[model samples]
Target chain A: MDIHEYQAKELFTEAGIPVPPGEVATTADEAEDIARRLGGRVVVKAQVHAGGRGKAGGVKLADSPEAAREYASAILGMEIKELIVKKVLVTPVEDIVSEAYVGVLIDRANQAPLFMVSPEGGVDIEQVAETNPDAIRKQSVDPRYGLLPHQAYALADFLYDDPKLVRQATKIVGQLYDAFTKNSCSLAEINPLIVTPQGEVKAIDAKVSIDENAFYRLPRVEAYRDLDAEPESESRAREAELSYVKLDGNVGCCVNGAGLAMATMDLVKYYGGEPANFLDIGGSSNPDKVVAALQIITADPSVKAILFNIFGGITRCDDVANGIVEATRRIDIKTPIVIRLTGTNEAEALEILGEAGFSAHTSMDEVVQKAVQIAAQA
Target chain B: MSVFIDQSTRVVVQGITGRDGSFHTHQMVAYGTQVVAGVTPGKGGQTFEAGNGARIPVFNTVEAAVRETGANASAIYVPPPFAASAIMEAADAGVALIVGITEGVPVQDMMTASALVQDKGVRLLGPNCPGLISPGKSKVGIIPGEITIPGPVGVVSRSGTLTYEAVNQLTQAGIGQTTCVGIGGDPIIGTDFIDCLEAFAADGETEAVVIIGEIGGTDEQDAARWVKDNLNVPVVGFIAGQTAPPGRTMGHAGAIISGSEGTADEKIRTFKESGIAVAERPVDIRDLVKEGLGL
Candidate 1:
């Protein structure tokens, strides 16, 4: 649910927060055009869902439109954190007098939305909190009442000395809080809220992560999800209603629950084999979901063996057995599958698998070890 | 003897007409739980036939169900979209314990619902949890009744099947449990490991405890600290996702390794430092539980 910096800035702008005028461009020509329109030194930042883009050479300061185009061309296809840059955000560089940090995120410990503000900025806030703990001032906003004017000003006062700067920062903090709550964001931040030489405060960099569960309520925020930025298998798994994470190992794991799925993956590693992916078919087992899960797992050429570990609480073992059987019939699965099915009609599920010429075990350890051995040999 | 529920727990089911609600309701009834009432918005006044051919009355709202049936406990199987409201409704009805089995509830909604539940002084378990089971006495939510037996150990976990795996192993090893509770896998859950731990610490039936945790949040660390400061019962702990990669959610929304925190290695270290036996594998939980109990 991570949105591009430009998209976050768009939200910031919509919420009345001052942001450096920026345009997203997919091509170098568009970048040049945007720079020309801005009529100043522009910053070309790669619009990828990752941090440390500047350190990875995905961001550059361009002195002219031609320089902007050059930077765009260089960064367009560059890979940062395994994600290829498909677009660049072109924004006019601001004349900054000082930099500060402001952000709001769901504090898991407090079970509330916490606003963190610091005079120090342009670096990881976590590092700042660790190194100079006194620099960061935090306030938890009750979701019901939201960030009151006083609370916002207190946070602003911590980051600024000038009355005018504090007023502007307070307004910006309110706007950021509005944007966060309106979009159902898990995290929203304006890293390096820059103070101009003229004393105007504005957000220079934006980061907003929408809570995935809120997608049902926030259609606009859900639409901001860039499918191209995610791996194909992940999106496909999402569409199939499967919880999947592609991994680097050779053994593909399909389990019923998230906890058990992780346990299964850990067991795969425990037996001296790596898991190629983490796939959860979830509580309700349908043949089509299993087929989709298998297809997604086998889509990874690195997968040498597949494992199914179903504990079957709400999920029926017979349904999973039917899925494995139906999936093998519909798709040509080249990798060996080791299944451990137990609970909820397990005897019937074993019969179904046995008749389909597939052997199933009841023990998790034996099946995981067998799958690991098979994957290792392959 | 159980920490939460026993045979006396009068249960009302929210979303009773729904698929998951009906299925688990039948399971709970079959497990000998006193499923007194059911709540379905438009389907109120209908009768849900339990496994024993007993007709359970369905009401339109939790308040009505609570009033009519004198139900003090509620198990929720509502969809994610309505789960928060359902929890609030149950809490508003003055239900002492509300168990939510719905997964994928928006974190913001849960935050509000949690606040309301707290204001009402009600205990809310899992908006995405498997609920709790007092073995051979009362079964709530979706934990299979057959796997557990009434005994001395108290089980608390943030997982569903992983809890079952530990319970299954314990049953195989002739170690039975007093009550097994799933605190859920969400980052912002109502009840936590510490809440269940304190309850178990006070319950005379629970001689020892087994905790199943995953790589997410500092709940485990906090729970370990609580166990150290309080509680005399020996505790065994196991954390899943030992091999899980960072920043990727293993399965549950809350089961992600954020930054350097919420890792299995860190949790295991904290558990050892707190004098809780750490099980390397799920299969090893039984042996650790036995050791914790001095069996």
Candidate 2:
């Protein structure tokens, strides 16, 4: 659930964090209007859910409104890591004296939101942590009490020596944590927290990833999803409560559990076949889910065969068998389907499959190997 | 004897009136687990009829359930929103162990609840897990009792159906397990490979161990190092998500490769370095287990 930089800045503003005013434009005309209103040099940043935006030529510093439109028009349809830039953020440029990194994220190892601050900024923090770990100072915040004022100051002190700069940095750190917790974000960062020559601290670039599990509470953050940046199959699968990740392969994997889904995909490669996609039918026992899965898989023309390996626990195998039988009738599935189901009414499942003129295997290895062979041949 | 639970372990079911809770409650009772009490917040002062005349008392809170039934452990099946609080409730009630089976709980909530768990010195198994089964003794959470049998091997996994798949294979191949634990696949689970392995190492009944891990955290690698230095039992390991793409969370929130970290190849390499046999496929686990047992 990665939101665009402009959306993150909006949240940062709401939290009383200082961010340069920016407007998101879906068109070049809109970008030009935004730049003209700002009446100064502006930065046009491509709003795509990916890194390397600068390297992809998706970011440009425009000295005029006409230049802003030109940059936006060029970046709008451009792809960075295969994500099309459908929107661009037009913000007035800032005169920076220095840059620093500040961020907070749910650290799995610490079981809390961990704040990381670095004097080095405007680069991949992961790379920095790897090459020069000492440059980055980290603090694990107690999610119960959140980032205390003193705790924020300790992290802020590492980024600045000036009293005014440290004070602003400390406030920005607390404000970032506020935005992170309020939006149920998994990660929130202000890369290149620039120190203006006028002695002001402001966030120039923002990245925030929302935790989908918290969507039940944060309705506004959930609405920040950009479908234009997502793959069609992925968006469609989400509509059906299925977790899908498309891959360039011939064997289409449909499994019951997440871990099992990955293992099935791995086994497809182990048997010398690439998996077309990773689709988890999840705990939904509805035949419609199976129909949805079939439609999503067959939509990809590269899918030579469909493989379903369901070790039913909470998910019923009979329901899946019925789903396969029902889906084949509902949708004209030309791809050869191979199923391997075991546990939880397996006999009834096998009977349903047999009656539908489809033979199913109970061994995971056999079905994966069979599907891989069928895909390779097709 | 199992690592966590034995025949003497008393159980309390949280969210007992819910769909999954009531269903697994009956399943647990049918398998001879001592499900003494149930909790449903407002549905207290009632009896949940778990067939066979097993009328379990329902309390409004975990505290009352623990006090009334002397329940030492809790099996949680609450909704995602309330699941973390339910875990904290059980921990606050002084339960030694709490097994959370609810999925979709916010990581932030678990972050707070798990920290409280550590402060309370209570063991929380999972907020999204299949729980544990002590083959033919006592079972907690949702592991199917039919697939297990009392034996010398102990199993620890970070998956649901995958654990069932492996345990079923072991049972079908006559390699009965003493207990099979699903520590869960969430990013911030309360227990990890190290905790389960330590419990198994202390348990005298566990002759051999099988570690089932997936791509995500460095928990498996950390467990590998700990096993190499401390434990002496024969260990066979399996790492899922070998072909999974980086950055995309494959089914589990925690099962993702971040910047070339927590990959199956890396975990497998570490397992080999720690002298653990790595099962290339799920079915290969049976043969590997047999080999480890020298059978």
Candidate 3:
């Protein structure tokens, strides 16, 4: 759900937020052309998902179009914080007098939307919070009442000293809140909302995470989903309706729930094995889903073993056990399968597996240890 | 003596005509829950029954079921997209408690639905949780029936599978739960640790409470304060996210980028100050809860 700076700026512009005119260019020649069109003095920013591009030498300033082209050529395809730079955002450089941060999110505890404003911006907000907590002002907005002008003004006052600047800041905060509520954004942030010497406030950078659950209502936003951007196994898992996330290990894990999957990974590591992935088969035990999960795990050559720790409740343990017993036949699982079955029909599940010549354990520790040992051998 | 649903609590199943709706409904009934009515949008006047075909009438809406059968609690199996509307319908019908087992309900919808439910004085447990089960008492939602052993440890967690992990750990460590609730993995859940803490505080059967929280949100801090000020009962807390970083989203859609204040270290420090024992490892939750109870 994270878009590059250029993509975020495109969204901000569509929302009528003032941003410097910019064009995304993949080639050095194209970047120079774009820089010339923006009057030769432009900032070349690497397009990556992560922040701190400037500090990482992924951002550069060009005095002329040729310089922009050189910078673009140097950055293109370069790995910046693990993200390969495919394009560069070339924009007209701006004069900034001050910078501030503003963001909105749903405060679950109070059951209200919360808006935060900090006097200092552009740097990591966590440092500001740790160093000077009082500088950050927060307001919880009632959904029924919405974020009013007074609340925005109160935050704006903290963010600015001059009356004109305060007024402009308040308007921007209002607009940000509008975008947050309307777009179903879990977080809508304007980091380093800059103020030029002319006393105008504009959102210089935008970071947004639209609520994925709200994707049905916002088809246009859902279109922004880049399946290719994700790991191949993950995108494939999604297509199969299995929840899977890649982890930093070699042993592939398959569990029934998110919490259990994480615990399984943690336990694997505890028992001296690195979990390669986190996969949840959900509550259903359809053999097809199991086969799909096995296929995804086996697809990763790093996977030395597979662990199935399922506490079947709605999903009968027998169903999962059967699925595993059946999945091995459908998919060629090169890795060892360590199964832990518990809950409803667990006895039947064990019997079913025992009949199939599969040795599954009732204890989680035993199963996890076995997987780790098997992986170590591999 | 348990919090929320007990054996006497009358249950109503929403979306009971569907596959999951029917399956869990039957399982709950078989586990000895007093399931009195089923609600499906277009199927009114028909009846669905479990054991021995002892019929319970189906209604088109939650209000109709409540009026006809006096069903006061609801377990919703409606899919993610329609879950918000279903919960709203249950709240409108004046169900005292609702447990939504459906996952993937957009956090925004849950936020709005939670507010609406709160406005109507209805308590919601979760949208993506495994539901709540009080052994030999009442079962609502979909926690496995066989894994529970009715005891004094009140369990609460943000993840369904982690709830099972805590329960299994407790079971292995010779600790049993009074009632275990999966608050859900989603960041903006219907209920939080504070709400569950309040319930455990008042429940006579709960000798101690075990809480499992994740990396995002300030709920852990809030719960720590609540446990310190209001509750006399012993509490043990284990906050997840040892390897997690701030401003990074985790598994749950509701989880992520909550800021430095909601980190695991901060929460653990606060909980320690509040006199609650902090479990260093998730597997130690049961031992911590047991020790907190002086067991």
Candidate 4:
């Protein structure tokens, strides 16, 4: 649900937030043409869906259109954090006097939208929040009332020097809030929102995370979901309507719920094993979900063992066991499986699992240890 | 005595005409839930029943069902895209509690829905979970019909099967649950450890509460703080993100909490500091729950 910097800037512009005029180009020629069109010194930034592009040599300052093309050509297929630079954002570089950070998210405790503004910009705000909580000012805006002008002015006062700067900052905060609520964004951030030497504030970077549930309202954000960024296992799981997240480890975990998968992974680690993935087969323990989960887990070469931990409630334990048995029959599963089956028809599930050269465990530690040991040996 | 849904609770199923809707509805009804009405947009005026011919009338909207049947709680099985809208509709209709079982809903939708629902004093359970079930009474969700043999442990988990895994181990250890809630996996889910813990703490049937949380968010820490200050009920905590490599997200969309403070170590330490029994292993959860209960 994250979009590139250019796309975020486009969204910011649509919301009437001031941003330096910029153009995206995929090739050196396009970069030169765009730079020439802008008719001034430009900043060429590598377009990737990752932070630290500036630190990673993905950004360059060009005094001439030819230099912009050179920088663009060099960055055009370069890899930054595993994401290839598909495009470069060419913008008229601005002279900045100061920088700040602004973002908005839902505050669950207060059950209201919270806006965060910090004087420290272009760095990890989390570190600042942890180390110097006071540097970041947060205000929870009531949903019905929205973010008021005074609330915006208070945040602006923390960042701006001149009163005129406060007026511009207030407009930017208001626009950011509009973008956040209207686009169904879980996070909309403008880092290094630079105050020009001339005293006008402009957002130079945009990082947005759209809420997946609100895709119905914004097709543009939904279209930015890159399948390539997701693990193959997760993509397959999505197709099957199961939930899966790949981890960097050896034990393949198949549990019925998100919490259990987490507990399963945690236990696997506690027992000196690393979980290869987080797979939730959901409520219907249909043999198909089990089969699908097995397929996804086995497809990963790094997976050393498989763990089936089901606390069957609406999903019968026997059904999950049967599905595992069925999935084993359908695929060549060389990885050893350590299963812990509990709840609804567990006796029947144990009986079925026992026949398949495996006995269910009542102990999560025992199963995790076994799985981790087996995976280590493998 | 049970938290949320009990024997006398009247339940309604939203999107009951669909395949998943019909199947889980029948299962809950068979498990002894007082399922009084089913809602489907265009499939009203029909009747669906459990195997025993316990017929329930169908309505097209949540308001209609609420008016006709006086159902206070709703179990929603609508697809992901419509899930948020469905939850809002149920909340608007004045359902005291709503359990959303759909997955892959966008976070913004849930944020808006969560804001709207909370504003109306409606509590929502999950957007990608098996929902909540109070064993041997009127069950309201997708938890397996027969796995629960009611006891005193109140279970809350962010992962679906892990709750089952925890419940199963508890049950195998001859422990039964007062109520088990699967809070779902998505990052922007409706409920979290704090919400479920509050419910468990208030329930008279719950002698101890077993909380299952993952690594991604401050939910575990928030719950730990609440436990430290709140009721006398013994609370056991298990966090899932312990072994997960730092920076890897979970299956539940809400499973990842932004920032470095969201690590499993932080949550575990917080829970431990709050005087809650912290279990690093899933199998150990049952014992922790028992120890919390003074069993």
Candidate 5:
């Protein structure tokens, strides 16, 4: 789960990492007020769940409170990568002598948290990786031992040559590890780990993404979820035990598992049709869950055809068939519906669908082709 | 000659009194697996009426269950929050193979659990996977035994139902498997494709293998390298998520194509370069397997 830059700073501050004071403002006037309180010069950054904010013109440097208000007005409600800018972060501009990048993320191959420190900063990390891979130094921290003091000092050397600057960077590295592991963050980064002429190192830009699987223990952090960043159908689908992602297509897909769901969508595209959405009814599905999935799929206006491909294992096909039958009674769906169910209780499911005036196929290829054909005709 | 589970494998079902544990335990017994014991902390001394009239003993802890039943393998059905600890407990109790059936375990938890299990030299399969099944012999985890038949093909996958989809297609087409393993879809899974591939390579019965992969990480690429370097047997592969958008996780937490890496195109390219046939769709898996095995 991606949090706003300001929210990440809050976590950094909690971990005793030095960060410039920042305030989140919802209105242009509020941004101006925050700028005036912080100082005359401030940076107004659009607070949305996206990257390349500066390139997208969501970030602006203001020389005065009036300029801050103007920038905030222009940034707020502006769409960057299809997400509306609902809030702006106002912070005082700082003087910087050097810029470096420091980050920690879970490394799948190593099965541990990997700390990366780069001499260069504030530019695209991926770009730097492709261009000058030598600039980046990486160290994997054993989750059992954490970032050892020597490991932190070793990683800190990549960012600075001065003793004082290296010392401060080392401390920030330790604190960053704390913020990452303590918060159960999958990724935490500090771009432009700036150093002033005074030999002080601080995090100027913060980005932290929490692991949603840990939300069972971190309720307070779960409250940071930005509902506005997600679509209404997605939020509603979560409530109904479904995983959904909206797309620009005509065939709506509802399947049993994640891999099968993606495969279903891929097959739809391969058969010359675009999927309206990606929906997983999930394992252990019942009639009610199937009904909920159908309702959500039919709710999309771009969906010209609906397809259900369930290879039931833990899920019973008959249960899903009952749900589809139950959903047709509740929702007035005008789109064409296609279903292909095989596996446990297949005979019972086919009987249920046939009696309900629905034709169910056994072959995944045949069913996907039929749905694509129907959607093309529609 | 199966790789992991066979008729001789003694199984213990963790969280056996719980909803999922109880349901799948009966299924395992009904399939002729030797379900020797069950562990449900407070339900110690209670006996579970596993199908086939076998009264399996339930113990309070994995340690006690292991001691009493001499269980060589464990199937975890605990909830996500404590699932990592359950994996650790199974390893601590000296189980040779630990198959974690629970989904949604925190990656941080797995970081510690997976490392500890590795240090102990124990094999941990999935924290979010349907376990393995050696058809007509032994069934462990949640994979349905009825969809499988004992034969020459071995399967490893990153999905639950999708594995079933491919396996069912194979079984219906008169093809059978030596053992089908679901390595799971979590980013920090206990086992990877290479681990299962190595096991299948060692087994004499596994003539051909089917590898099912999706977007996320370069594990599939590494597995392709392993296949090219180590194994000589024919391998057929299928990668889902060709039409999936980048940065959006498709249900499985690990099934997302981030940046330029971990894309279906990249995985498919690696598979072809390694001399493995790539299936364009799930339904195409059976024919590719047939072509690889010279059937």
Candidate 6:
């Protein structure tokens, strides 16, 4: 779950990390008021869950309160990476002598939280790691023991030369670590940890991604999820307990497992047809979930063909067949559905579909090809 | 001949009173697995009839079940919130192999649980996996028993139904398996491709190995490198999610493509470079496996 910059900075401040004073505004008038309160000079950054906002013209420096309003008006409704900017964060401008990068993320390879600190800041860290590998120093911190003071200082020392600056950066690193673990974040970044001319180090920008699995434990962090930023179909799917990701294609896929769902989508492409979405109805074959999945898929006007490739293990094929039959009665589905049902009472499921005046395939390849052909014709 | 569980493996079912636990427990028992005991915390001292008039004793704790039944292996069907503790408990009870069937266990919990299992020298299979089947010998988790037959090929995958798809096709082609293992689809899992590969290499019955990987971390790449350096058995590989978009998780939490890493294209390239036959589609796995076995 990605949080906006303002929310991440709020967390940073709560963790005792120094951040430029900021306020989130949903309107241009609110942005001007915030800028005025912050002594007129501010940076208006579009609060959207995407990277390269600056390059996309979603960020600007406002020399006066009126300029802040102008930047806010330009950025508020702008779309960056398909996400609409509903709000802008107005922060007081900082006098920076140097900028550096500091972040902590779950290193999947090491199976631990890894702290990556670099002297270079405000650019893609992956590019830096590829171009100048030595500039980035990484350390894996044991979660049980937490990030130790020495580990934080070592990362700070890699980013700074002045003793006073190192001390401040070390404290900030510790605070960032605290924020990371406390929030159950998969990623916590404070890019451009700026050093002022007067030698004070502070975080100028913040980003955090919370682990969805940890939401059960972290209620506060879970509450930070902005539903308005997400697509309506995605939210509806989540509520229905279905795993669905919308894509740009014509064939809509509904499968039982994650890997099989993806394979089904790939098969759709293999047959010269694009998949409209990735939808996994999960292990259980609750008829309502299937109905909800179908409704979600058909809601997209681009979905010309719907495909159900179910290899029932824990899921019962009969239940899914019943769902397809029941859904046709409850909802008016205009798109054609191609189903490949096998395993776990498959014979019974095929009989159910047959009685409902529907034909079903027993092979994945055949069903996918049939669906693709139908979608192409449609 | 099995890499992990065999005919001699005595199993204990965790969360036996729960919905998924009881259902799969019945399936495991029906498949002729020696389901020695069950653990349901509060439902100890009770008996769960497997609808075949077979009464299995249920214990309150894994330690109690292990002590009473001498259960050597355990299959977990506990929920995500308690799955980590369940794995740790199984390890603490000295279970040799633990297969966790619970999905959605927090990554941090699995990390800690994995560390504990390693310390105890116990082999943990998955926290969200479909578990392993030793063909006609022993069935552990939710993999249907009828789809597999005891034969020469060994299979390892990070998926559930996709593994079944491969197994089904292999069975249809008259190619049976020694063991089919699902290492789970999470970012962190107990058993990895390399672990299963080494085990398959040691098993005399497993003449060849089939590895099913998806887009995610560099586990496949690392496993490819391991196969090159360590094993002598022929390996056939297939990576799912060729059409998966970047940054979007394709159903599986660990199936997201992140920053120039863990793509199906890259994994296929690595497999080819490492001398493993890469299948373009799931239907092609059987033919590749047959080629690997020289059949």
Interface RMSD of 1: 0.9
In model 1, which runs have C-alpha deviations exceeding 4 angstroms? none
Give the winner by DockQ: 3 or 5: 5
TM score of chain A per candidate: 0.99, 0.98, 0.94, 0.90, 0.98, 0.99
Superposing every Cα of model 3 onto the true structure, what RMSD results? 2.8
- Measured against the true structure, the TM-scores of the candidates, in listed sequence, are 0.99, 0.98, 0.92, 0.89, 0.99, 0.98
Please report how far candidate 5 places residue B45 from its true position, in Å: 0.9
Writing each residue's lDDT as its tens digit, candidate 6 over B90-141 gives 9999999999999888887877888889889999998789999999999999
Write down the lDDT that model 1 would get.
Answer: 0.92
How well does candidate 1 score on lDDT at residue A193?
96
lDDT of 5: 0.92
lDDT of each structure? 0.92, 0.92, 0.81, 0.83, 0.92, 0.92
The per-model DockQ list reads 0.82, 0.80, 0.50, 0.54, 0.86, 0.77
Please give, for residues A1-378, the per-residue lDDT of candidate 1 as tens digits. 789999999899999999988899999999999999999589999999999999999999999999999999999999999999999999998888999999999889889999999999999999999999999999998877889999999999999999999999999999999999888888999999999998899999999988899898888878888988988999999999999998899999999999999999998999899998888898878899999999999999999999999997778899999999999999999999999999889999999999999999999999999999999899
A best-first ranking of the candidates according to their DockQ comes to: 5, 1, 2, 6, 4, 3
- The per-residue C-alpha lDDT of model 6 at residue A32 equals 100
Task: Choose 1 or 2, whichever is better by lDDT.
Answer: 1
Off by over 4 Å in 2: none
Please identify model 5 stretches exceeding 4 Å from their true place: none
Better of 2 and 3 by TM-score: 2
Model 2: residue B101 alpha-carbon error in angstroms: 0.2
